[model samples]
Target chain A: MTELNELTIAEARDRLRKGDVTSVELTDACLSAIEGAGALNAFVHNTPEIAREQAAAADARIAKGDAPAMCGIPLGIKDLFCTKGVPSQAASGILEGFTPEYESTVSQKLFDAGSVMLGKLNMDEFAMGSSNETSVYGNAVNPWRRGNDETALTPGGSSGGSAAAVAADLCLAATGTDTGGSIRQPAAFTGITGIKPTYGRCSRWGIVAFASSLDQAGPMTKSVRDAAIMLEAMCGHDPKDSTSADLAVPDFEAALTGDIRGKTIGIPREYRMDGMPEEIEALWQEGIAKMRDAGAKIVDISLPHTKYALPTYYVIAPAEASSNLARYDGVRYGHRAKLEAGDGITEMYEKTRAEGFGHEVQRRVMVGTYVLSAGFYDAYYNRARKVRALIKRDFEQVFADGVDAILTPATPSAAFGLGEMKNADPVQMYLNDVFTVTVNLAGLPGISVPGGMDRQGLPLGLQLIGKPWEEGELLNCAYALEQATGFVEKPGKWW
Target chain B: MSIDTETAAKVAKLARIRVEEDALPALAQEFNTILGFIEQLNEVDVDGIEPMTSVTPMRLPRRVDEVNDGDQQAKVLSNAPDAREGFFAVPKVVE
Candidate 1:
């Protein structure tokens, strides 16, 4: 029998609807796969009991014949999302034993659509690092290897576990949040598809806030069609989240016509950074060629402020993160350090935070506080915001000039070995967000589709960025590229 | 733009994160490196450019001044490490 764990969301939905397989069987296959693949360490919390319960419920819902596309489909939830009664640590030590009393709007919506939750996936500590090594549960290993090489590679973070789990066939799809390229970069590294929908498209009500302006939730899946299918269920206007866009949710899957005739794809010259790997450059050209062959007019554009995006992102994201993270003081919830006899309220707060946060999270919090301080606010935070406006204006000008989307390499390189940059300068790890941060800075929708592989047979992805609030149109462009590239290679399972 | 140990300690104090004596030097070094990289933003001419606080331009949504939902105080305190008398208990400040 074909392993039910390997079925795409779309394929599993078809099988579920036709009574070809029960959701219980599918869920069982996934549970066993997860158990057998413990070496990957993709899931920090495994809820097999809950999985069987939700799958049974889904099977009953499917029998009623009015089920949604996600009915009976098994999926993974990133630890960043608060699933009520489940540990949602955000992979940070501070939230060590915290169980949310309420559910995140995205995960709640997925559950309401009848998707079975396999468990909570691992991620960077408070979504702070580029590699999964920062995760409190330890690194989530990528299933791909360089021709029997025993070197363990990273599934790019802060959505590392989501990427690794989906790529390793541990689940059909998973949830991921992008503050600065968390979803797209990981998807590119793992040879899967991930999309960061336009900001406010999805409600941030219960998802742990990290750079509130840039954090948007999206899907990590096996194919572009699966992303379209899962994204429709994950987005909506939530009155609870004041920033949620008050727009009607459209059928995202319907937008994928697999046709991109007459669309204009912008190739930003500023993205062509010096010392960029030859494989990455060649893969970008191949993406442009494929888009042109599919009839998208490839035009070279200039985002002059591109050089400052990483710096701007580093400042603004940390500034917002500092403010958002202040809520974790030894207070009403989360981990609290042991207070000594002389320790007062201030000591309690300080010790709790110092012990709770990891090195990277602490570094960012300090950086954020420094920039937002009285003397440096205008020079650092305010200046970065103005540069952010210029970056947004650059995209607006191109869109106004009839460009439908932009194409670039999803990551600067392919999946790097774990611990490769663990002890390197912090700035070196921050460079991983080079290509993908601009979209978050602009609050635009972007997707990473597997275009081809590097020399070691690891997958490299090409990113397509679209105008704000045009995810449907963007999905269509990605669909055209997905069809043209024909990249259906899966990572040979070593885990 | 350089952050030495004194400035790093001040920033850590403001952020309410405790840095030990040994960790302060490392923290200061990391801060200086980050600040050095972010200094590149000064090269750009952003005169007269308004700071973008949000991507979409919309006033904050207003809710009618009426109680829409509540009454689950128990559920709210379920995750609380210290809850007493329907309120979150904290270290005493007024003693």
Candidate 2:
């Protein structure tokens, strides 16, 4: 039997509508679960007072018999999102004690829909690292262990906390932002579902900037249907964001008819990376087989520029980050370093940023500054931009040829132990995004669904990349794959 | 091209992040490894390809030139490190 806290968003919405459950009871269940699972370190900031108030309000809204699907549902908001009057640090020391006066556009949409805010979820500092190790709040441990091994594992990052919280049932669902696979990778590691919608699908107005062009906020939830339901609430055209697409938000949940009959699902040949784990390869074969069984045509497609995606991302994301992060110069808000005598504004800026940002963040800023420098701009930044065009064109070509969706392994392998890759070079860590970054580069929608388990009993996820602005179709394909695979395994409550 | 400690120092200064003199060699080496990895992009022949300014084909949305939000100076300055006289207080800029 599923606990109240463990209920998926779709199930909870129905139960609440039928008067089988109350929002306050659900909130208390999640709060108690969060309190008991302190070792996970997923939720860095708890707002029980606000949660209770919102629960009461959600209960009243439901009593009116006009509540939305997310009404009375509790969700953990990612720290990357600016929640009104809540500490909205991006897990960076630079943002210590900082709170937003207004809610992020996406979070406000969720609030307006009557979802109760649970608390702030932890993430990598400025969403830079692949593992949660770079977080100022430390690691958000994965709820799953490798066949009873006591050694803790990373729930992936920079949405590690969202993945962990959802997997551990700390919240029914959580919000996550993906720039180069932050949401999907962590979701893959923690055995949950995460979707990075098309870049302009969700408004980026009030969300803290990472890589502006690549960053997108999407739902991290227990199942694809929940993702579809929550994504409709999270996405819409917003005049607040200049990049926000002026498109209609479809009823994504209704689009899940579980019928991908005769739809073409492409298996991209280039995603078959060298030195990939045997289990991941096996999982990809399983996904393809399941899709074929679901009556979807499986075709071998090629995205030739796939190998160059990570390198291009490293260039563009950092260049934009350095420019975006320059605003945190110790004057307006957030951490301001203590200055010694004879220090001016320049010294202040230098000292504050050096002290405020973590090692990975600083390294990225330094690399960003270098690539955008006067001498290297054309060679590094501009060249990468042109290559990015190629990468985007590669997907456009495949989709233009009538490919509905593409399937690949979400991560090269399942979750790894904490600090396992700390000693490896940073590029070694970056390889984790090799499969998912291409979708971001092409500004396409991508969803990661837990497919099957590895030999160690750890879960592995299969990713489906869809054409631009076709998340509904993509989620349907993922839903069909989900039904075919029947992946209903939950992580043991070790935490 | 491999970055040296001197180049790394220059990059750090340019980024306005302080790196101790002893840390320069390590930072430079780290940059070297990353730059080496990034060098893979140089192999792609992108000579005539247009640099992608936007991923989705959309022109920048134009809005009427008007201030849509204002007032609440307290909220604006609420999170500032130092605020005085309804303005952000900064360290002295001129001698």
Candidate 3:
């Protein structure tokens, strides 16, 4: 029998189907891995009894020949997603001790597909920070290393725990949500593959909203094929979410043809900005060279409005977040502060919100409120919206010119030292999202694949962006690149 | 465009967050830093450009006028910490 730690979801399903391994054994392996790697801090909550019971039921179903597509595969869900009876805190003090009675659409879909839940992984508070440091739970340590050094490095965030768990072999696969590169950035930092499907492709119904228009749930896995399988299981239309797309869901796994011959791939000239580290520039060129070797037609294109993406995203995301988070008052489903003498209902609300939200969340809310206030609305929010439209129009023109996909670096540079970014001003940190935010603003599908490592030996990721609703083609190209580059490997023991 | 401590405190109050007066200085400094970064936008020339709201230029579809969401009173009120007679209870405003 293959050791449960090394088995992929497909292999686990095959073993379960042949009656060679019971779901109980697979769940035990994952639970053991979680116990063994407790120092990694990948999981916020692990319920082995619940997982084993679910897995046993799945084993019974398979014995009765009624196995689902994701039968008995144990997966880690990011804590940002709501799971019924499980506390969905978004790793924030504000939402401490809150549990949703209903499940998020993606988590519900995974459960319906017969996947056993391993546990909820950690993330930044309200998905605010780039590094997982902002999490009420501590930062998730990276599962990679520099030679002879065992210092704990960040796995990236706000999905750091999801990426680290998968990289450390603690889970077969994990779920992540990307808003301004949350999924892809961490996946790169941890040497994993993650795809952020187009916005609205996955219903946002029970997801704790962080910038609703940009927020999208995707998969973080060991390989492109694994990501494809998980993405297929996670997508669908729901009337509950008015923004959810009403379209036919395609078999993303079936769409993976390891062929990219004659495909036109565009390299956006604007993404090759000055001040980008030389190593990343080399990796970008290396990606182009590999694609060309694989029979792809590489061409240079320009997204002239690219420089405006960060500013535009900052304005719109916070504006939407400020509105969406208004629902989280003390009286509702989250933490409520104790009332003092002479305090009325207004005081109760003020005190509760003050104690509940974190510094970053509060800062965002203030900025959002300031921009949307009556006098500043048109000057800030409205102007930012116009720039967002121009950015989309730029992509439309490029795609119209026969470019099937665009290639860019996932981030400006590889993972920096743990406290290197935390103390910097917010906009400096927001600039790290420069390359990925444009895709979100355009509502296009984007994926991050392990391209190569930097001089410091940390891994680098190359992003492939596709037009709206073309996730299948986008992932197919990613699989082809994966085969061409061959960059997938386990992180060194220092992790 | 730099914000002072008093302005920061007022902004926090308007945003429904409570910041102790002593903490207002730090908040003001942080806000000024962020505003300083946002000032980069002023450097760009956007002459004759129309402001955009969403990335996709398409307008949202409108549904016919009808009462579609009026039936979930109990479910909605279930989340209320203080509800009476099937309505959310707030402190009376008028004297």
Candidate 4:
């Protein structure tokens, strides 16, 4: 039997389909791997018995010659997504015992495709922190490092667990959500491939939303092809999500064309900031060189409004988050604070909310309330929205200027030591998403592919920002780059 | 602008979050720090610019005026800590 840790989702599926391997065996191997790697803190919950039963059902389907694309694959689900009968805490103490009766659209689709659920992965509380340290269950450590170097590195947040699980070979792939670089940043940190499709491409029906307008669900996998295959299984229009697009779902697997001859690729001048690290710059240049060698034309373009993206996102995302999170009152679902006899309804609300939300979640809610307040709405929220519009317009102008897509570094630098920037104020962390957030604001598709590693052997990623609904072209370009760079193998130490 | 502890307490109350009286000073400090960061926007020349509500500048398609959802009262209240007769039960607010 091939080691479960080394097999990609595609390889595992092919073997399972041909009766070379059974879903039960693959799931058992994954469960054993999880048990061995318990120190990594990748999972918040594990359901071995449940996974076995699901795998048995998948095997029965295969025997009957009826199986979906992702049938029988063992996968880790980020805990933020609602799984019926399974507790879906956003890794926060507030929602300690909350369990949803209905599954999230993404989770339901995956289960319907015969994907076996290994368990719920860990994450930062309410997907707030960048270091994954804010998780109530504890942080997920990166699985890669030099020999005997025990300095724990952050697997990135708030999808840190998903990335760590995929990296540690605990599962073939995992579901991840991106709101201001959550999915792509973690994937970059853990040396995996994650794609954040265009806004509304995937349904957000039951995901515990952090920032409703910005939150998007995507796939995290070891290779670009696996990501594409998983994405095809996860995406579709849902009538429940009013924002879900009615556009035709393209066959993402078939879209993986290893051809980029004569494509116009834009190297945005704005991405080259004044304080970018030398290694990141070198990696960006290496990515451009590879693409150029693949018969693509590279052009220097300016997004003059690039500097405003982070500030605008901070304002808008918090404003929406404040509203979306209002559902967590003590009267409804989630944790309720113990109240005295004299305490009234208002006091109940105050106590419950104060006890339920974490510092970062509270900070966002406060900022959101302040911005949306009667007097300040026009000054802060309104003005930030205008800046967001200008940023989107900037992308449109660049695309109009014959640029097929934009290539830049996924993050400003490789994953820093855990807790390195956790206390350096919020703007510092918000600045980390400067390159990735603008694409979300523009409602366009963006992807992160493994570019190469930095000097310290930490992984680096190259980001591709495509025109709205142009994920097909973006994936083709990424496949071309993935083949040319050939950086898909796991880190030696991680193995 | 400097935010005092009392004002910070009021902000917390208005936000429906409770903070211990002793913790008010720290909350006040954090609020002032965040306000200070937001003050940076004043330096940017946004004069004569129209405020934008969305990045795409496209209005979402409006549905016809009709009742659509909110019929799943049992499902909605199923997760509640205390629900009575299909409604959230809370302490009395009347005098």
Best by DockQ: 2
Candidate 3 residue lDDT tens string, A38-105? 77888998877779888988888889998876878889999999988888999987787877767999
The runs of at least 3 residues in candidate 2 whose Cα sits more than 4 Å from the true structure, single-residue gaps closed, are: none
The regions of model 3 sitting more than 4 angstroms off are B43-95
Per-residue C-alpha lDDT of model 1 across residues A131-212, encoded as one tens digit per residue: 8888889999999887678899999999999999999899999999999999999999999999999999999989999899
Evaluate all candidate structures by whole-model CA lDDT and list the values in order. Answer: 0.93, 0.94, 0.84, 0.85
TM-score of each: 0.98, 0.99, 0.94, 0.95
Q: What is the interface RMSD of candidate 1, in Å?
A: 1.0
- How well does candidate 2 score on lDDT at residue B79? 97
lDDT of 2 at A215: 95
How displaced is residue A311 in candidate 3, in Å? 1.4
Model 2 has a clash total of 0
Name the best candidate (by TM-score).
2
Candidate 4 off by > 4 Å = A492-495, B43-75, B84-87
Candidate 1, residues B1-95, lDDT tens digits: the string is 77888998899999999999888888899998999999999999999999998888767899999998799999887777788999987777667
Question: Evaluated on chain B only, what is the TM-score of candidate 4?
Answer: 0.87
Task: Identify the superior model by DockQ, candidate 2 or candidate 3.
Answer: 2
lDDT for model 2 comes to: 0.94
lDDT of 4 by residue, A56-111 (tens): 99999988887976999999999999998898999987898888989999999999
Candidate order by DockQ, decreasing, is: 2, 1, 4, 3
RMSD in order of candidates? 1.1, 0.7, 2.5, 2.2
Q: How accurate is candidate 1 locally (lDDT)?
A: 0.93
